[model samples]
Target chain A: MIKAEGLTKRFDDNLAVDGLTLNVERGEVFAFLGPNGAGKTTTVRLLAALIAPTDGRAWVNGYQIGEDNINVRRSVGILTEAPGLYERLDAVQNLTLFAKLCEVDDVAGQVEKYLRLLGLWERRAEPVGGFSKGMKQKLAIARALLHEPPLLFLDEPTAALDPEAARTVRDFIGEIKEAGRTIFLCTHNLDEADRLADRIGVIKQKLIQVDSPANLRHSLYGRRVVIHLASVTEPVRTAVSSLPFVEEMQQMDNALVISLDNPEEQNPILVERIVAAGGAIQFVNELRHSLEDIYFALIEEEDRETQA
Target chain B: MNGAKIGAIVEKEIADARKNRMIILSMALIPTLLVAMVLGTTFVMLNVESVDEASLDEDELSMIPAELSGLNPSHALLILLNDQFMFYFLLIPMMLPVYIAAYSIIGEKETKSLEPLLATPVSTSELLVAKSLAATIPAVVLTWLSFIVLIIGGYLIMPEPVFLAMIRPVWIVSMVLLSPLLALLSVFSGVIISSRMNDPRAAQQVTGIFVVPIIALSLVVLAGKIFLSVWMVFLAATIALAVDCVVLYFAVKLFQRETILTRWT
Candidate 1:
């Protein structure tokens, strides 16, 4: 649904978004993970056609970013980081205004429906200025979805929400994905990205590293195994280390943690070795690297490259 | 720009402005107070005339002008009110549009709603045009309404035939039409200034400087150094309207949504 090639944005002397190429498929939740000033927001603005890209090109739903900007905007919904809402207007009025701008038919009904869906129906009449941060965020989401656009650009949509509120937002995002809408979510929350993103892009400076979360995790750290043993003795440790497939082993209290060369080929043999050695195992598991680990590792790697 | 989108923008702005009760009340109340002050001073000056007619000098009589010849005390007071008070009174109304428009854009930025508005499907031209219209329309209406009230107050204080004739259609044209064109110029200028500056106070203070020209014009017109002819008023309006168009064009050109989001301090 979205394609970007060598997309770069420069502000005077500083390049905010570097030559980054990425793609997001229809019905996919793509998370843009970055720290502060990592060009995440800049990338979002570029896709939304709010600014012209200095280099490269992007297409959203087949509409070119700069050339068919208006059409692209018409086909996309954007929720900015700050929840840009008219505080004087109530939640319903805010959605109604956006609906009219989007040229939606039956704006009032759409506004009401979105308000109810976001659980903001009870406070629809109160001015948004008085709303809590989470409430304002929900209203912003409702505004973005008011016209049912096929593409959604969300920047920190659940940034300041309580856990429950954040979950509600995340679930709503899941529903959008289930409905086959394309989502490009810019966020700093690794957990949110881990839960919602089908593919994750880590951006630092102007460069972007795009990969599936699983692939990134594997690249950052090779697979390892966790063995919960009834007892960890010196003989078992030495024996496990003697196995050609075992690279390293560490004994904790009563458990043995082993780093395997290839868990699929080595785990069953290692289990037999443990049993043959008169060791009883209560549980055995593989440890997969998480998105957070990969994210930090990549960012640290980028920092080192710059320093070098 | 499509009319429907522009209409939507206009409706939203008007609704937002209405909800800002303090601003609306201030906009309404300032003009009323200005008119009251002008009329109140006129009444006081008229009533405080010298009790001794013999002590009145030829110079003071000349100050009253040949226009007051063969008129009663009340007629003389009416002539003085129009000749002296009307220009400054109109100055207040002219300044209102500048403040209203400047605040409209700058205030939105201060509140951080401008980015979301720019993110919408509505075109840049539509947003600027709608905001400009919303600010200018009320300014024009209020100026004309205040002018009517001024005329009524003048007539009530001093009933005179010449006073009725002095309420020329040309004078109404200058206040109602020309003033708003000038207001539009101020508003567009103010929007540009506000958009470029991050500090709302700085934006407001800088744009408030446009009122200097209006004040100067008021002084010149009131001092009789420049007789405001219909052609002159029309020329000024035309010039102002042209400047408004140019400023509006630049405002749209400089208003990059990405730039705003990135450069936000």
Candidate 2:
């Protein structure tokens, strides 16, 4: 639903977003990961047509950014980092205001639907100034979704909230993802992205990497299986290393950490070799890598490569 | 432009103004100060004896319009003072809307609402016009209502002849026609200044200078330097309309989505 080519934004001499080319498919939850000043918000603005890209172009929902700006804006929903609620206005009034501007046919129906879905129906009468940050953010999400646009761009929705409030927003995003809208989520919370994103794009003023969380781990570190054995025998290591299918092996205490090209296909052969060589078998499982581990490694590696 | 979207924004601004203490205080202060100034002068004109030709010079006295020249010298001065004070009504619409208009765009920056609002399909023209109308409606309405009170209060106190001076075509055109134009000019100017500025106080302080030209004109009238004929009123109205267009254009140009999104620090 969203596509960009060489999308760059330069604020005078300082480059905010540098040559970002990307594609987010329909119904895909694409997470954009970056640190502060990583051009994340600038990229969102460019894609949403809030600001024109300095050198490149993008299309959102078949409408080209900048050229077809109003249509592009009409086609997508963006939940800005700040909730941006009219604090003096009541929750219902706030949603109603955007609903009118968005030209929604059933303003009240859509307002009530999202408010109830986000668990904000009870407090709809209260002034938004009195709402908790989490409540205000949910109301903002509801405001963005009032017209039920097909694509969504959420820029740091859970940035400043406490863990509980952040979790609420994450779950709220989870529910939004399930609703079948293509979401382009920008988040500093790696865990939230890891859980919610169908694919992830890492950037530091440049498009560094884009892949699913699992694929990123696999590409960065080839598949490895950890075999737990009751006792470490010298022959067990020699036998596991002798297997022609084993790509690499390391012995850690009583476990054999073995690299495999196809663990499902090749693991039985390696296990057989270890058992035949007089090693008592325990169990076997694939080694899992956290997104944080992969993220830092990928970022550091990319940063080092760039510097080199 | 979408009338529904503009109407919604205007409606929202008015509702917020009603709830805002700053706007409410301004609403009360403007009309009260105006009524007090108008009534106080009307009372003075009621009691003063006619000025003899020997006291004030012919050149100074000649500034009164020929229509009022036949009245007592004091009545002529009353005509001048009342006309000059009509200039103050122009100041009312011009002055009242600036504060709110200054706040309209800049306040959006403060609350960080501009992005989301702009994220919608509302065009720049629609947003600027909505903001201008939001500040303009209340200000023009206040000036009109306060004009009514000035007319009624002056009628009760001043002589029939001087009271008649207050309702002449020049003052009527100045109030009903010119003042709304000046109000829009004030609002457009406010929106223009606010779009470039980071501080609402500074924007308002800068926009408050709009009163200076009106005040200068008022002083010139009071100094027996000029009399506003019907032609002059139309001329001034035309100029004010032109200036409003120019300022509105600059406001639209300066209020770029890129500048606003980047510079709203």
In angstroms and one decimal each, the interface RMSD of every candidate reads 1.4, 0.7
Q: What tens-digit string does per-residue lDDT give for candidate 2 at A132-223?
A: 98898889999999999999999999988888988998988888888899999999888889999999999999989999998998998889
**Candidate 1: share of reference interface contacts reproduced:** 0.79
Best by lDDT: 2
lDDT of each: 0.78, 0.87
Best by TM-score: 2
What tens-digit string does per-residue lDDT give for candidate 2 at B1-265? 9999999999888877777788789777977887888789768766676577678877866676666677878878777887777787788888889878877777888889999999999998888889889999999999999999888888788788888878988889888889899999888888778877878779878888878888898898887777778899999999998988898788788777887788763
DockQ of 1: 0.71
Indicate the worst ten consecutive residues by lDDT in candidate 1 chain A.
A205-214
lDDT of 1 by residue, A1-308 (tens): 99999999999998889888888898888999889988998898889988899999999999999898889888999998888788988887888888988889999899989888888999989999999888888888988888889999999988878988888888999988888898999998898899889899889855547878877776667677888888887777777889977777878788887887578888889999888887889999888777888888889989998889
TM-score of each prediction: 0.91, 0.94
